[model samples]
Target: MPVPAPPAALDDSPSARRREQRGWYFYDWANSAFYTTIISVFLGPYLIPVAKTASCAQDFPGMASDRCVADFDKLVAANPGLGYVDVLGADIRPVAYFGLITTVAVLLQIVFLPIVGALADHTGRKKELLGGFAYVGALAAMALFFVEGDRYLLGGVLFIVANLAYGSSVVVYDSFLPQISSPQERDDVSSRGWAIGYLGGGLLLALNLVLYLQHESLGLTESMAVRICMMSAGLWWATFTIIPLLRLRNRPVPAHETTALRSVGGSFRQLGRTLADLRRFPLTLLFLVAYLVYNDGVQTVIGNSAAFASEALKLEQEVQIIAILMVQFVAFFGALALGRLARNFGTKRTVLASLVVWTAIVVAALFVAEGQALQFFLMAFVIAIVLGGTQALSRSLFSQVIPKGREAEYFSLLQISDKGSAFIGSLTVTIALQLTNSYRIAIVSMVIFFVIGFVLLALTNLPKAIRAAGNEVPDRI
Candidate 1:
């Protein structure tokens, strides 16, 4: 595929670039509701109870026989707290299922996102592609409203589809960063977009949490309230997406044939070449390695926090929801604060500092015994401080070193590395939970990834990588 010409308006003026940037930021706002409410806070906990019901119904067919509905209700009433499900005579925990589902999704994205990224690089209708994928995911998320009472299969399938769409759309969305911002401007621009995403996600989570807290007053059952809260994330994602869909424009590209099969082949070839070319830039590859390892820990921590709170800490669902909301809102400021930290101390140092904090958080988490909601909240607050900073700076810093005219392709690798790491992280947590039957031990296992990433990051030569990519290194680094 031929590299597209940069738009004169976007390339020439700061004001025009800034205007385009605002539009770009909205895409983060558009998708984060799904991440915040559906994935991070509600779905894991919700699915556990639902799946438990299903598993119990299967085991005790007597309960689900003639009076199926009533029996199931009776069972739930009898055993209010269902811990593990017996599947084929083996015990399966909810956290294990959650980890398995997410790992599968990440694996799927490993194959799927590169194709989307290549298409973004080759095609001109990026706006259409972004909106199309976003809505597909949103629709799947909306379907979660119906996943009640042992519909674990439905929940799993919908999450895989939604997460695939979410990750694919992100590839296209991230491809726009290099197009919208110059090298020097990328750190702040990326940080601002991340900040906006946290704010949008937090706003929706807060409202949903309120609805959940007041469900009885609103004449709704707790189950119905949870369903509505999950559904609203989809609505929020779909509704907020209109701004970016309308406002962001695709740049002119030299058109190329992108038939289904042709695009597939092209993506594989692009991926192979990119992989081979990495040998020429060792620092960039090292960074990818570092990111893959540490980010696995990050993704695992975020994805499983609610489950950990419920299963390990024995915290109420309300407390978990409120804690996640706190993370989202606080992360909004954390992104900006980290950006300034990067300015003062360099991006690499700021990120390193955040990693150190992550290590501390994990260590502290191991000591947070069951029912210690206050300890969990305090630990969550510290995590919020570093979450946005680590991610935003990582994106901006990586953007600095990728070769020109191949932003989409390289960022696709970053996405793959991210999801790939998640697969490992999720699997590790699941195995730890299964073997040790303790969340604290599972949580502590994540520290190895950070330690490995931190050591590798310390060895990375950012200045050399920047120069090799034919871009000047930011003085701040």
Candidate 2:
């Protein structure tokens, strides 16, 4: 295939753009609630106290087994490196307890996402997987209402399930971008999805924030308010998700006449063949490597920043919520602006710019210390600026390199690749914090991933990949 004239192939008509944007937006709106409610704002903070109590059974089983805190107290009295305990004097750290639960969840996704990708392509059950995972994740989130005291273990269990669903569903949702849009138009479509997701996640988080801060004022206990927020997120995920399933057309799965076991076996075998395509799909491979590294940094920020701020800097909960609220809206517009930039300057340039901004933010973070709410809040705006832009543009750029009809499967492998990179950022934070006991330094170190990703991304042959993928057209020289 010859290099495509992206302008002509993109179908820049208002009608085409509108349809692509709408679908993209709806999907984001449906999924953002999980990131906002369960992973970031609500669950982590709420789980901290409970995990301390639960960890006693495992961490100090010889002493704390009876009342859950007896041995914990003894260990503390003996001054045994017990910093993991909370203000109420309860265990959470070496375990990263909640993180451990979700780490297991991501591992499930690393294996499961790729298989589901193959299944979605072979079976044409893309939306089914999307809807199914959305509800399952939601239900697991709602069940979080039951997590209390020693129930932290249960919370961990539910988190694994909920996150697994969320991860699996995203693979399919991301895959749909390339399938539904022409090669050139995918960025616009992907951007709309990201913008809408940010808005949706923001909206629910905003309401949940109000509910959280004013639980007693609203005639609800803090625990109940937390539960209600968790439940609402699930319902929100379930309800809004129906829109795409109803409106979108389903493509039938490939009609390969093979046994089910053999078909499954073949997808695994073909994994190696897919690797071969990587060398040919140079930009796609480079972009994947870039995304793997940068997204690790991004996910680390999203997943751990609040905890770092709260635990290390000793930030008030209200301040964190407000900053997160600001991030949501800022991200919504940031994604929109970045998407427009991609349309004008191409995906690589725009995404690289976002990465540059992220590098600056992390570098600036090194100087932010103590309970500097005002400083962190200011930094939050910078975070919001690049947050949506990098993710949306990366998705769109990768979408251009993928062929049609393999969205779910390809994106599944992409998700797996992405999750695999997370270990790097997670390890970076862990090693730094363990060695230096410095969350501040750990937070600053993530910037290296962003900088390196941006430089590597600049060198990728994206135009060549587009041409090889049969997505390119002739130039009108």
Candidate 3:
């Protein structure tokens, strides 16, 4: 992409910009409930019992079926259950399956994100695009209410569709950042959005946690409570989205096509041009590569944490839920604090510090023994502090390095590549678990990604990249 002319910067009055930023914050607030309740806290654990029931367990004594399933009742007649049972000749663990399901979902993002991005840039209807994808994903998440006993496949399919929609919606949502705020204000605005997301997600998760813990007393079965939690996330996501949909304005491109097919074709041509132009922005490309590697580690830790706690640490589901709730509230402050830190430190340096913390997190997770709830909770606390900081800062930093006219296109690449990178991390963990039967060893692979990302980010020439992309480099604290 030849460096596009720097567009006139956003010159909104202070109050108007603040209003737009608040609206942007709500989209994060809306979608994160689904991410927290479904992806992070509940779904992985819920799927295990369902998959176990669906497995060939009832036929265990009658005959050796093709896919072996340990009869939970017979194996643990005295205890609650064996942690896992065999399926398809492999000892099926929820963590392993969760990883596979997440991997598939991220892979789907790689296919659709570019097209979504192109359409957003060409059509100038990003708000509508965001809502379209978000609501579809919400519907998919709502359908998870029907994923009952012996329906693991249905759960997996719903998760994939929901996750794909979630990721695609984020691509459009992130592009709005540059439009709402100038480069100088992006870190603060971006961090605020993430903080709001944590609050929203945490608030809803807290309510669902109470519902889940007191299910019997409330005249609801545990399974039914979990189903209701999943359905609630979809409702929460769809409802809050109305704020941003009503407030955000589309950034118009000059002479953009009107027809859908022409718009798509134009998007493809622009995408090709953008790829060729990448070579001119070496620092941006380097940062993308670094983000691709490190974000994978970040995502794997997040995606697998609840499952790891339940399966490896043997924590109760309530304990896992509470721990995640703590993470959400803590991360809310963490993102705000990091935004201030980025003001004092440079964005690159602040993000690199978070990566160091991330590396230590995985290293520490390896030493945490099974059934060590306190140790695991402490580790989760440390993860919470860095999790939002790293992700929020990375998004702000990447926004500064993309060309003026193509925020959506570049952010689409970021969103897709972020998920695309997860494929390897998730696959590595899954394969390691299947082969070695040790999550501790499986998690160590993430350290390599963080270390490499830190080194590359440290070496990146941010000032030059910002200038090359026709963006002003924001001042460091």
Candidate 4:
């Protein structure tokens, strides 16, 4: 297929760029509903119960006639090896299914995102690709509403599709950072995007929380209410994505390169070249490593905090929900506040400072007594303060070092580091849990990731990295 030239760039006036930035922010708003509602609040809790039902039927055939009436906890406790569904003769634990599916999605992205980025850079269809992936992901997420009874396998498949699309859309979206904003404006722009995303995601989550809490009064089954909330995220994602699709403009790829590297096969070859080219930018590569390590710690904490609250702290489900809501709302202001800090203190220093806070938070987790809701909330509050800032700054900083004309390709690699490292922290926690039989020790062990990442990041010379990538260094960076 012939790769057509992209549409002209948006007007270069300050107002025009501001308009583009506003539109770009909406993509963050649109997609975050998926992260907050489905991934963060609902899916694991909902899907695991569904998987448990399937596992009950498969492992305890007697319960099949009763619709799996056995108490899941008691059954698992008694059997110690129950609640597993066979996947091609492999016993897959019900609780592990979500992580398994997530791992699969990340692995797929690792293999394919670079190609997607290469294609976007070559064809300059970033806006189209962003909208396409967002809508596809929304549809996949919406399909979760139908995951009734023992449809855990169906849920897994849909989640993989949704997650893969979500990650791809984000790569394309982040590529727009360098395109739409000058180096000086990136920190503020990226932070605003994250802030708005928090507000959007938090608003939906608040509504969902109400729906979930009052399901009985609302004449809806708890499962059905959860399903509706999940579906609503998809609807919200699809609805808001239209803003960016309408407002964002695509920059044309150079004519000679567009004609020469138009094919999917050609994009793959370009990806190969990009991989080989990474050696030319060691500082950029080192920053990615630093990000991968620290961000893994961040992701692990976010991913496992609920489990920690439930298992180690013995917090109620309601308390956990409230804490998550706090994080969501507080993070909105936190992102903006951090952006301003980055403006004054520099993005690298601000992120490093956030890492220090993260390490402190994990350490503090060790001191929260079991069943102490207030103490747990205090820790969560601290986490919320730094969560958005660290991630937003990291995104903006990475944008600085990416090679010109290869924004999408490099951001694709960043996306890999972003999504691909969660398992590492999880594994570390798992190992710690196995050895110590203490969730506190396991949670605290994540401090290592932050320490290592902070050390590496502190050593990285940002101006050098930027210049090494043949890009101009921003004054603050």
- What overall lDDT goes with each candidate model? 0.83, 0.73, 0.83, 0.84
Off by over 4 Å in 4: 1-10, 61-71, 256-262, 419-423, 426-442
lDDT of 2 at 180: 69
Candidate 4 per-residue lDDT over residues 194-218, each given as its tens digit: 9999999999999988998999999
The TM-score-based order of candidates, best leading, equals 4, 1, 3, 2
Model 3 worst lDDT window (10 residues): 65-74
Worst 10 residues of 4 by lDDT: 64-73
What TM-score should be assigned to candidate 4? Answer: 0.92
The model with the greater TM-score, 3 or 4, is: 4
In model 2, the worst 10-residue window by lDDT is 86-95
Where does the lowest 10-residue lDDT sum fall in candidate 1?
64-73
lDDT of 2 by residue, 1-477 (tens): 455333323354567546654764686798788788777777777776576665675566565444545344446546657536342343346325545555566677777887878776776667777788878888887888888766776787888888888888788777777656665566667777788888898999899888889888889977788888888888888888888777555555545535778767766665555667668777777778888888888887777767777766779877888898899999889888987777777677888887887888878877887899999898999889878887877877777677666666668867753422265676677667556656678778898888888878888887777777777631210
Per-model TM-score, in order, reads 0.91, 0.86, 0.91, 0.92
Candidate 3 scores a C-alpha RMSD against the true structure in Å of 4.8
Candidate 3 residue runs with Cα over 4 Å from true position: 1-11, 57-95, 417-421
lDDT of 1 at 378: 94
Best by TM-score: 4
Q: Give the per-residue lDDT of model 1 (tens digit) for 1-477.
A: 576666554344788778888988998997999999988889988887776666667666555433543244355446654445654465676557777788789889878787787777766567888899999999999999999877777888999899998888887788888878887888899999999999999999999989999999999998899889888999999998998877677877654555867766766777777778899988899998898889999989888899889878989999999999999999999999999999888999999989999999888887897898889899999988889889888998888888876777778767764422277888898899767767788888999989999999889999998999888777787
Arrange candidates by lDDT, descending. Answer: 4, 3, 1, 2
